[model samples]
Target chain A: MPPDAPAHLSEEQIISLVAYLAGGAGGDLAVGIGDDCAVLGGDQTGLVVTTDLLVQGSHFDLELMSPADVGHRSMAANLSDLAAMGARPAYGFLSLGMPARPTAAFVSELVGSMVAQGRAHGLKLAGGDTVKAPQVVINLCLLGAMGNLAPVLRSGGRLGDAVCVTGLLGGSGAGLAWLQAGRDPAEAAAAEAVAAHCRPTPRVAAGRALAESGRVHAMMDLSDGLAADLPRLARASGLGAAVEAEAVPISPAALAVAPALGGDALGWALGGGEDFELLFTCDPGEVPLLAQVVAEAAEGLTVTQVGRLTQGPGVTLIKQGEEEPITYKGFDHFQEPAP
Target chain B: MPPDAPAHLSEEQIISLVAYLAGGAGGDLAVGIGDDCAVLGGDQTGLVVTTDLLVQGSHFDLELMSPADVGHRSMAANLSDLAAMGARPAYGFLSLGMPARPTAAFVSELVGSMVAQGRAHGLKLAGGDTVKAPQVVINLCLLGAMGNLAPVLRSGGRLGDAVCVTGLLGGSGAGLAWLQAGRDPAEAAAAEAVAAHCRPTPRVAAGRALAESGRVHAMMDLSDGLAADLPRLARASGLGAAVEAEAVPISPAALAVAPALGGDALGWALGGGEDFELLFTCDPGEVPLLAQVVAEAAEGLTVTQVGRLTQGPGVTLIKQGEEEPITYKGFDHFQEPAP
Candidate 1:
């Protein structure tokens, strides 16, 4: 085992391997690896827990994001995992790594924002740890209660299940692109795009409705866009996925800002990350009713079908009345995962 | 507020303020701040959770600690918090910030040790997330079951309660000192000190027994030694404390190595942190029976009474028949507390 031996696996594969090696779901662990949150206590009625960490440079740009925005987004990223499982936010433990010379005001604002964000969804901050580090780091472990509803897992999808998405997509991706280019924030659509990137809402109600409807077979939050996230869902369910190019729900902000930014809306819709929307698979016969259920549950936020789960070895895109193989590059923490 | 304005608050005060502002124990939160672990669901039943984060440069010396040692200590530290509350380990979520270009072997050893350590206490790794970081950062969130036993809190001590401690003290602190002094590990008393520093056994059974005896008032693991941790316990209980210097349990290893290292075993025993023993307050009437119960429960370990909780404004150390008010300058993350 040379120290420089390059790992040949992808990030997803590496995570799966880690999960597999770490031991999968067992007694009292209803679902473990390859799920939005680990289901503990029971299958349908127990606790769901998720943990996430965000670094300063890798996760956000300080030039554009205020301390409050950083805290808010960190909370949003973790809560979305709970939303994917339709778990009610309960309590959170936040561990912070502050810079060595951190000012008291900065530390106070950063923590205050996280507490406020947790309060928005009825989650309380119970306890935490703070240590000095080179840069600001936050790790949040959230526990949610799963009362009387089966946590919709990524592995439950069946072949031919209609693939649906909540709200629009790519605004967050387009927003980051716009901001990274140092574009004017006062310009038309810039504020919307920036806000989308900084504070995307988690689709909690929509996910809960889908789970309660008993029509959805699988569900996951679209943090990594469809390109990266769809394959995960399909792979977890032991199926494949297909996306209709024209049917993809591109955000109005992305559509409006893409031309000025010299980007492609459809590409962003397909591959852009940080959308914070819900992606799901449901019985095709109940698509209309499920859409209605989601809209009614989430205050007129419509969930539209983009494609279907299929019996295949990989994901494909249907465009111009022809299906073509697609492997859209997406953000992965690892350049190449360990085998 | 100016960003650079000096904030006159200590780290502990800052933490307490945050907890107070965030919200104290309410609803299902049995105990919020000032406790080893946050008790959730009910007072005597349900769960307890604790979170801790360890950074490479600040918390550990990579030169002295292998990846496996790092993993082991990280798990041990979090589990000690559970022991203080008399909770049985259940599951854990480990979030990692892996350095870019990490060796596969290093990653394997690090993760494997953590999983193995969790299994020692019947805790399983449920799920986790990883992002690239400049240095290795490990954050573990552990949950344990209360199982119809009341969680011992730092705020439970009463006036005139006898203060007690489990096992020996100062071995870990002395071990760290010896290693930092560049002493040979093969020398006399060095191996024991190094092992004590690397993998201190948590007093899980002792804590459980003390809780079961129903005579223990307040309890906490001695992570920060008597000088630092005792004040915290006293403040939490809204009382003062007195420690008899002669009665402080000094580890044989610390005593043996102190002369050669030109250090005072008494000072190390008082100010030295990371002892991982349980410091508790109990009813004086049950001292004899409590000691027997602890000995029986924890496999012949002795629990010795050292002092008493008092009705006063501060802690005092009684040395050689002289009572002196002592702050002792224990380990505080902040240089000075903020006002």
Candidate 2:
């Protein structure tokens, strides 16, 4: 850090700085920062908007991921935010910055992947802006609608609510590890892990089903791993949570990569990020209903109850008959080493 | 350009490539790539969204513009797109990429400028993403509402509509020239021109009023100069335009810098970009109403009738009682010399 630079300010500090400067989104903006998506207009006819950026060196590497995968992941990151709000994806705006004039073929491949991913979730590429830059930066903004259901927020969790997560965890993290290790791409397990990291799917239908169930209290996507993101949901709801370590689902691919990486599969499942899966809170009695909703919406997808909300503030992990408080720390852009 | 670099493709070619690869925003997206803002939902209860990117080296220089100015201009660029669609500004999301760890004070200054500018137009800063990058990049996505009127798209102009522009032109272009020449910043004229270039205001009120009048047929903002942007509007509407060169409004500040820069004021007004003013079209009979609406909404701002739509395709400049077909060329990112 330079003499004039701030002392390794955390992501939370930067967010607070922005909040302090911006005050609050009064008037038309119903929900501002701290939520899965910014809510605009009223509940009757509202819009949920979210924006995410994918930097070349920080978020991805050109050597590891194809341009098509980059495009897909960029859109998926933003669409997942809308999914967390249970909003139906509607329109998208992509702003791309390239280091130099890329070939027409490259541009087509990148944009085609975006369009294809968007079409899967009923999203349309409405418009975007392009410019030359020092590196490739893709910023995607997605707009979604509440449809027949009201938008779900991260601040609705209550004490004793069941904390549940969709799909398995740590696959993306293990996949990233495998790719970084330069493992053979021809291996079936390695290929699966890499695909999980490169093209993680957003749980749009599952989110919509959960929202329509009227049982889900709080919801958000697991982008920064369970250890980091669950605390956000807990803090937003003015509560704490106790997650059962044994109940956390570690994918087969993650388990396979754990021994070679010299780390436990459970640790990766706890702290690994970029899963793009939904983590929600619902009434303890509604867990079965939530599972049914997910089963009906997406075949083969499982919703597991891994924890329960508590009245106290802060998250704790119950592992091996012991309780350990979890710290709130995600992938900080400034603090963490560049990928 | 490198042999594989597409030979420095023009901006138009890039746009066409994007259009071809993405196809069109069919189904829910009412208006797509060719318009100023993408329209979602129906005309009555629709949403307008637009995104713009500001690169540190390409769009602004740190030495020339303050952080506040960069923030203000970033919001202004997106707001101007909403204005072009005659929509009321609603919410905004900013995605910022910084080269290194920024100071708290610097972050506050940049975000404060964005909040202040957004507040002026009844817009609010909802949320955003931040990350470290090789250079500063600000990407803003603005969402707006039509508010009792249909969105006035760039393709609404007919064969006989009158072409008009709000405020003066070339001030920003001339300001860039003056700043590049290292003129004394203390001089009133020089300062005013620089301000125009650095902090050009979007004509939100004028745009809203025009849409309310139901007289303006088509609209867009002049960000790429008349010589370039007018052709876009013409091509979108499938009509030609005959612009009266003498009628185009050139700012006094532009005229003052022209001689020093060895350029004609009219040429700068026509070809120079970044004059964030409204360029709209209306029926000849409704021109008076359009002017009245702008006068009532924004005092001291002038709306000048500089051209009329023709039955053919392409833009022609009428000067000295003769018609000169205008070429379709503007600031192409890949082709233009780096600033």
Candidate 3:
């Protein structure tokens, strides 16, 4: 673990680091970490790729984050994008930056976590680069397959489509609020919220099911809260939407903690980021079947109809007796945080 | 661009940024950028990938660097890794951490320059993530193909082979020194040296030739200066080497600027980092064709037989009739800069 000792990097250490991180699923990876470029099994067929970067200080704080969580979240963020496009992940290319004096154990833990998550997602860590830097930065690019299926884009929604979301939201928002308030929650609540923040479960199965149904029009993962992201899908599809306030699904756990946190459960469900849930729209005729399919495919996750796409250009929230335009604002990269 | 700008970006600006960074000489990339995931036109293939992060104040100074140079260098650094492995570049995924309110023209110029340089090297900018941060940080991940060629690894060399280096060195070190001293060089010399510092040329063709020949036993790129990197390659290959100091290819421009910069030109060539030239070793029999093949393959680049891989396990420097043990010291990430 000493900074100067390279001998600590035994064969086991190397294997443990790369076993899950790089290599081909079909055993066609020519070279892995010991060499420079990984030689993959080749045939010019299909490649689906997406890249994302997560900064240490910006995305996650090292002081409060688990190395495994960092690794999991890094891969999860990119995989969520792939899921939204209904792609089956096959391989990944990662580039990492860390301080030179960092413990090999730290690096190993991160890589080990990546390997575990990558395998779970049916992806092989094919190759990546490492360098010493001021911050621990991760740039992960996933290569996946869209076999026989056309990718679903955000521009496919049409008028009369039912806007839907898979699973409950606001858990991540509650967790962030807990952390920000500098007050710790009880064991079960804290664990649930923290896990929501740390390891997001991307709705890959629901996305795939939607893509296969031939009824669902548009789909995207909710990384930036639904209130902000819905408008993006709407704009892309050239349609507006109307959502009943009561229809938005808020988790019981989120509701239980919202009052204590001095934040609204509805607000988090509407605008919480990093939930990694799927927000989609489907034809009204296929609603029942699609909902059933999403429920079954998503391991009991709820598929709730939160809104309906209309032939217009803005989102509106319809409450008990009044309707108001839903401002499309969520997490802004440069905006000051709300007090 | 303002942070609150509309989500819909101008087609011209997007085109200017993305279109120019496409096209490569090797591999079948299925989807290149315009879509969600770039589909490499291949199936179940092994892939080699790497990423690097360049931070402002840590890597370079914005006051002294041009946007184009920043774009070029950030990408060039990652390309150099692929070059060291003799991999043909297919595409790159970029991740930028920019300060909010950055000049749109600056982003455009940086992206444009990256696109232009990518084309020159037969590399395409696939897609990437962008976010706001306090300082500018560029993270680039490259995906390359090695085909069926044997990847020249750092662990394959045997003793008694001729140690070779392609192209001149130490110009970047001298340039940095001159910049630190704040002493201006003659116009041409200043331009050349600074260019060498900012825009390193990765020896891709030479790397491919070295791999294709099946003669070179070991190889690596000189990014951390020869003094530091040669030892790394030797350590990886389980061998030692002896360098004839006079045999190193010194840049005339570097030599002209060294005295004014308060450093030795030879020292820069031996210890200056970021040259991105290839250093390798081959058997005595292969030496006959090494120069010819290198010239034909690398064109304007020069390859020199600088030293010999020895039976021992350490590096030795031989100058004139005198010999001394080489320290293998250069830019140590852990150590503070020379006082």
Candidate closest to the true structure, highest lDDT:
2
- Across A1-339, the per-residue lDDT of candidate 2 in tens digits comes to 123435545667777777666676666567778787888764315678889877889888988888898888888888899999998898888888876567776677688898889889978788888887777889999888886678999999999999999999988988888888887655776667678888999999999989998989999999999999999999899999999999998888798877777756777688878899999999898898789889889886999999999986889999898999986478788877677
> Which lDDT values do the candidates have, in the order given?
0.82, 0.83, 0.69
Complex DockQ per candidate? 0.49, 0.51, 0.12
Candidate 2, overall lDDT? 0.83
lDDT of 2 at A88: 89
Fraction of true contacts retained by every candidate, in order, equals 0.46, 0.62, 0.21
In candidate 1, the residue pairs with backbone N, CA or C atoms under 3 Å apart (3 or more residues apart, or in different chains) clash, namely B8-B337, B8-B338, B8-B339, B9-B337, B9-B338, B9-B339, B10-B337, B10-B338
lDDT of 1 by residue, B1-339 (tens): 333436654566557656855687888777776688988863223689999988887788878778888888888888889989988888899888876656666767777788888888778888888777777888999998877788899999999999999888888888888888888866877777777788887877788888877888899998888988888899889999999999998889888889889988888788887878899998888788888988998888888888999996689999999999867765655553321
lDDT computed for candidate 3? 0.69
Question: Model 3, B279: alpha-carbon shift in Å?
Answer: 1.6
Cα lDDT tens digits, model 2, B1-339, are: 123436445566666666665666666667777688888764215678888888889888888778988888888878899999989987788888886667776677688898899989978788888888777889998888886678998888899889999999988888888877777655775676778888889999989998888888889999989988888888889998999999999988898777777867787789878888999998898887788889899886889999998986889999998999887468777666668
Lowest lDDT 10-residue stretch of candidate 3 chain B: B16-25
Task: Chain B TM-score per candidate, please.
Answer: 0.93, 0.94, 0.83
Better candidate number, 2 or 3, judged by TM-score: 2
Stretches > 4 Å off in candidate 1: A1-10, A42-45, A336-339, B1-9, B42-45, B334-339
Which candidate number maximizes DockQ? 2
Error of 3 at A53 (Å): 2.5
Instruction: Report how far residue B106 has shifted in candidate 2, in Å.
Output: 1.6
